[model samples]
Every structure is written in structure tokens, then in C-alpha cells.
Target: MLYGLSYIFTKQATAVASPLALLGWRFLLAFVVMSGLIVVGVIHVSFKGKRLRPLLLVALFDPVLYFIGETFGISHTTASESGVFLACIPVAALLASAWLLHKYPTRLQVIGILITLIGVIVTVLAAGASASLSLIGYLFLLLAVVTYALYSVYVDKASAYTGIEITYIMLTAGAVVFVTMALIEALEHGNPQALFSLPVKHPSFAVAVAYQGIGSSVLALFLSNFAIAQIGVNKTASFIGISTVVSIIAGVLLLGEAFSSAQLIGAAVIICGVYTANNTFHRQKRQSQIEKKSD
Candidate 1:
């Protein structure tokens, strides 16, 4: 649900601030809050001897590119539509697994991916350009979804790092990248003071940033990494619907976003395809065999 609510938060932030500035504050706050916890010794994340390459790539893909694409996407599209587009992550992960992990997708998974693509097309056509859906927005959301899939693949590779360690690196990298961009944007606008003054004028930005930093970036990321470690990536991907469903409901109820019957039908079709592609029974068994052989 945290991931789902990220859209609502992103949408709210976008209304009050530009995308780069929003991401800047969100990830900066996340880095500061988590860093404070470390100072207090509430948690520990040691990376001295651990391999950092894979986790760095995970950070790049997720909290960096993922947030940039997602914030921009949400700015251009309805939160509900962003949620639907994000539901395609599992399908993207299927492909990523094939490429990164050398785990070829089964026929059913391929069918599922194709079905998801069809659903995406149907939803887009149903939405048209008239109904708050922008082609640019959908394309950015697609980029975000692909980054998330890549994140999962690399996180699987970086099994040596604990979840909190991974989360810390993500927050650190995101803060560095976005804060710099935010500064550059402020400079480009010749209003450096606005970086601090904008959020002060818009209190909603602070609220949204807080939720995103503390709830989504820190705690939720840790939980996701833990789940992936415990149950494996495919099983974790199977639950992608939980976030999608929550995002849809939150968009409709909280934001009063209106969606059409065709869009609803497309969402259902996407969910079914994601479900089919993400089925883990035989895949899990096979993955275990592969792991054993590798070990």
C-alpha cells in the first residue's frame, strides 16, 4: 500500500511543486531521517566488506530513475492511470528475469506479458488524449515500470546486502542525484531561494514529502527487500496487485478521480495477465533447483 500511496503523494506534490523539486525534497528528507536513525544507533547497516556494485545499480534503477520517471509521469497523468501503468511491473520483471537471471519465461508467462501489453493499449485507447491521459505520461510511467523490474533483478543479485543497507544506498543516491537537479533547476530559474521557500509556502508539499520519505522510502523498501529475500523475487512480484488495487482505490476515493468502464475493463485484463505471468508454483520449484545447482 505504501508504494501505491506513493502515487497519491507524488500527485499531491506535483500540484504544489515541479517534479524535480518534489523528488529532491522527498529523497533528501528520506536520507536525513534514515541518517539520523543511524546516528542514534537505532539501526545498523554495514557495507564495509559487502559487494556494492549490484546494490548501486539497484539504487540507480529504483529510487533514482524510478522516482524521476514516476514523479514526471504522475504530473502528466491521473494518479489512477499511473497506478494502472505501474501494474505492469510484474510483466516487465518476467522479461528482466529472463535477461538478467538467465531464467527463460515459460509459455504462460509470455502469454501473460502479451496480454498485459494488450491491456495497456486498450486502456490507452479507451482513455484517449481527451481523458487526462497523455502519451508522454504513459511513456514515462513505462520507464518507471521498467526501472522497477530492473531493480528487482539487481536486488536479487545483491543478496549480500541487508534490506536496510540497500535502502540506505537508495536514499543516499536519490538525494544526491535529485537534490543536485533541484539546485540546478533553481539556478536555471534564477530563483535559488525558491528551493527552500516553495515548500514553506505550500504545506502540502511538506506532508507529502514526509509520507514519501519516512513511510515509503525507508520502511516500505526495507520490507520489500526482506520479502524478496525470504520468498524470492517471483513470489514477491506476485503480490504486485496489492499495491495496484490500493492505488486505484486511493485515487478514486481520496482524489475523486473518475475512471471509465473501458478503463476498468482494461485494468481487470491487466490484473489477470499480471496474475498469469506472476504465477510462481513451477517457477519457484525451478528457481530452487537453479539455486542449488549454483550453490
Candidate 2:
């Protein structure tokens, strides 16, 4: 739900402030809030050995590239459309695992991947035919999904070495990157004050930033990590499909964005494909683990 609402907030916020500026403020606030928690003993932070490089890489894939792509993508495309694209994350991750980890997928997973690709093609063609979607926007959203999928893969490895405290480190690194980029953009535009000024221009902008920083970034991250720890990553990941529904509904209700019938059908197909691919892989994985245990 938080992740879905983040797309809405990003769409709303970008109307007032540029994508880079909003991301700068969002991560800055997230960094500050998380830092306070660490100081107050609400969350402890620690790092041992040479885990900094992997943590930094994870940050690079996530809030750095992911947010930059996502915010700009949402600005150009409808929130509902962007959400449908994001539903492709699992498919991207599945392919990435196969390529990087050499874990070949099952026949069902292969069919699911093909279905996901067909759905994407249909969605893009439908949107293009309607003249309501931007090609650049879809590309950026695809970048966001790919980068996030990389983050999901690498963070699992990095966090195992750095502990859950890696979340704070990743956020901090992301904060630094965003703030620097924001400043650079401000300077390039010859409006050095815009970085701080734009965010305060309206109450809605501030609220958007707060929700993104606190709710989506900090709270959502912690809750997801906790859920994964409790129920395992596969079970937790299965819930991601719900975010697509939430995002589409919120876009229509809150932002008054309309989707064509074809677009809606495309979104449904994408969701079905994602769910099928994700669960098939997880089920096969579980069975493999059980077989190994018996062996």
C-alpha cells in the first residue's frame, strides 16, 4: 500500500516541483528521520569489515537511479500506467537471477515470462495508439524496474553480510547522492536557491515529501524487511501484486486519471503474468529446498 501510494505522491509532487528536487528533499528527510532514530536508540546502526562497497552499490541502484527514473517516469506518464510497468519488476528480477545466478527457470516460469513480455507490448501499443502515453516515460519506468530488480538481488547479498543495518547505510548513501544531484541541477539551472525554495512553495509539496520520506521510504522499508524476516522473501514478495491494484485505484480516485479499456486489459494481463511468474519460481524453489533437506 505504501509503495502504491508513493507513485501517487510522486505524481502529485512532481506537478509542483521537479522530479530531481522532490527526490532530493525526500531522501534528505528520510536520512534525517532515520538518523534521529539511530541516535534515540530506536534503531541501532553498525557495520563491520569491508561491506561499504556493496552497500553503496545497492544505494546506487535504488534511491539514486530507481527514484530518478521513477519520479521522472511518473511525471511523464499516468500513475496507473507507471504502476503497471512497475509490476514488471518481478519478471525482471526473475530474468536477472537466471542470468546472474545461473539458476534456470522452470517451464512454467518461462511461459510466465513470455506472457509478461506480451502484456508489456500490448500495454505500450495500446497507450501509443491512444496517444496518451509517452515513449520516454515508459522507458524510464522500465529503467526504474530494472534498477530496482538489481537492488533486490544485490541487497539480499549485501544485507546478509552487513545485517539489517544495511538499510540505514543504503538510505544514507542514497541521500548523499540525491542531495548532490539536486545541487548540481540547481546550479545548472542558475537557480541555486531552487533546491530549498521549490519544496516550500506549497503545503501539498511538503506533505508529499513527508509522506514519501517517512511513510514510503523509512516505514515501508522497515516493514518490508520485517515481513521478509518473519515470512521469508518469497511469501513477502507475493504481496507486491496488491500494490498494482492500489496504485491504479488511487490514480483514478485521487488524481482523476482515466485509463482506456485496452490499457486496463493490458494492466490486468501484466498483473496476471507477474503473479504467475513470481509464484511459480517460489514454489519450485521451495520444493527444491525440501528435496535437498530430504536428501
Candidate 3:
């Protein structure tokens, strides 16, 4: 939920602050807080051999590259369109998993994915006729989706090697990347007129960045890692829909955004599809266990 709210606040901040600046500051704050945890004996780090290198890479892809891309992409697109498109990430992950595992989805699963896809398309088109965004921006958003899928898979794979610690390490690495990029951008563009000057034009924007840094980057990553540990990757991935629903509510209630009946219906269908996708796996796993016991 914190992760979902971060997007809303981030979009708000992006209105007043440069995307790179916002990202840099958020990660810088997260990095400092998390690193303090490491030093204070609240958290521990292990080298853990070469086995968990992929977790670091996934971090780089996700909170690092994906964040930067999505921030800029949202600048070019409407919030409604971006929200709907982002919700389709789980569908993409499911498709990617099917291809990589050579595990053809059951008929029911395919139907669910199709329903979700249709809902996403409906939401996108119903948002506005001028809903079109630049192709490059959309491509960046797609890249964000691709990395999100990879992040989902990798977090699940790396769960055995100390879940919370591993997550903190990966986030720390991502923070380092963001900080470096921010510093480079600062060097190129100059000192950004000082942090004190930030509140003069946009106090809300400053508050949003602080919330994103502490709540989303640090705390949400911790919760996600714990959730992935408790439930398997497929189950965790299904819950990505929760973030979509949260985003929709935030848009309607917090942002005073309105949607057409078509979009509402589509959202409902997509929610159903998400439920189906999750339950299908649960049923199949139970059936396999039952057969094994009978044998």
C-alpha cells in the first residue's frame, strides 16, 4: 500500500520537481536511513557467495532504472492511462513466466489473462481520445514493466538467503545507483537552487519526496520481501493488483479524478481476472498434493 501511495505522491512531486532530482533525493534519504540500520546492528549483511548476485541486478533494474523511466514516462502521459497500463504488469509477468518455464497456462488461466488485458485496453481508451503519449515514453514504461517482472521473479528466487537482509542490500545498491545518477545530473545542470528553496514553490512536493524516500523506497521494499518470503513468487505477484486498486481509489478520492462507466467496468473485470489467476495456481497446487498423498 505504501508502494501504491508513493506513485500518487511521486506524480504530484513530478509536477514541481525534476524527475531525476526527485528520484535522487528520495533514494539518498533511503540510503542514509537503511545504511544506518546496517551500522547500528539492526541489520546484518552477508557476502553469500555468487548465488545472490541476481538480486542486486534485479534491484538495479527495478527501483533504479524502472523508477527513473516511469517517472519520466508519467510526465509525458496522463495519470489515468499510466495507472491502467501499469496494472497490466502482472499479466506481462504471467506471460513471461509461461514462456520461460514452458508451462502452458490452463484454459482458465488464459481466459483470465485475456479478460485482464481487455480491461486494461478499455481503461486506456476510455481515459481520453487524446490519451496517446510519445512512443519513446511508452517504451520506457514498458521497460519498467519488464524490470518489474524480473524483480518479482528474482525476489522470489532469492528468498532463502535471508529475506529482509537481502532486500535491504539490494535497495542499498539501488540507492547508490540513484545517488550517483543524481550527482551526475547535478554536476551537469548545476546545484538545483538548494533544498531550502524547494519549499518556496512547492511544500507539498517536498513532503511527497520525503514520504517516497522513507515509506516507499525503504519500508515498502522491506514489506514486499517479507510477503514474498511468506508466500511464493506467484502469490506475491498476484498481489500487485492490490497496488492497482489502491491507485484507482487514490485517483478517485484523493485526486478528484473521474472515470467513465467503461473504465469502471474494466477495472472490475481486471480485478476478477487477478483473482482467477491466483486461485488457479492454488487449486492446481492442492490437486498435486492430493494426488501425491493418494499414491
The number of the candidate with the highest TM-score is: 3
Which ranges of candidate 3 are over 4 A from the true structure?
Answer: 48-52, 77-85, 101-107, 129-133, 195-202, 281-295
TM-score of 1: 0.79
Ordered list by TM-score, greatest first: 3, 1, 2
The better-scoring model by lDDT among 2 and 3 is 2
- Which pairs in model 2 have colliding backbones? none
- Higher-scoring candidate on TM-score, 1 or 2: 1
For each candidate, what TM-score against the reference? Answer: 0.79, 0.75, 0.81
**Model 2 Cα lDDT, one tens digit per residue, 139-178:** 8899899997777666655645433476676678778988
lDDT tens digits, residue span 1-295, model 3: 7876776897788777677777777877778887898899898877656476767766776787778667767767766666666766767666665665344556666666667666666665677645655787787777778877777667656755666576676667766777677668766777746543654578877798789888987888888777766765555565676565566667888888886798787678768876776677788889999999999
Question: lDDT values of the candidates?
Answer: 0.80, 0.71, 0.71
Instruction: For residues 1-295, write the lDDT of model 1, one tens digit per residue.
Output: 8987887887788787788998788889999999999999998989988887998999999888888788788779874577568767877787788788887667766776667666655665565534465999988999999999999889889999988888899999999999999999999999989888867898888889999889988889889988777765665665665565466668889999777898688778767767776675567789999999999
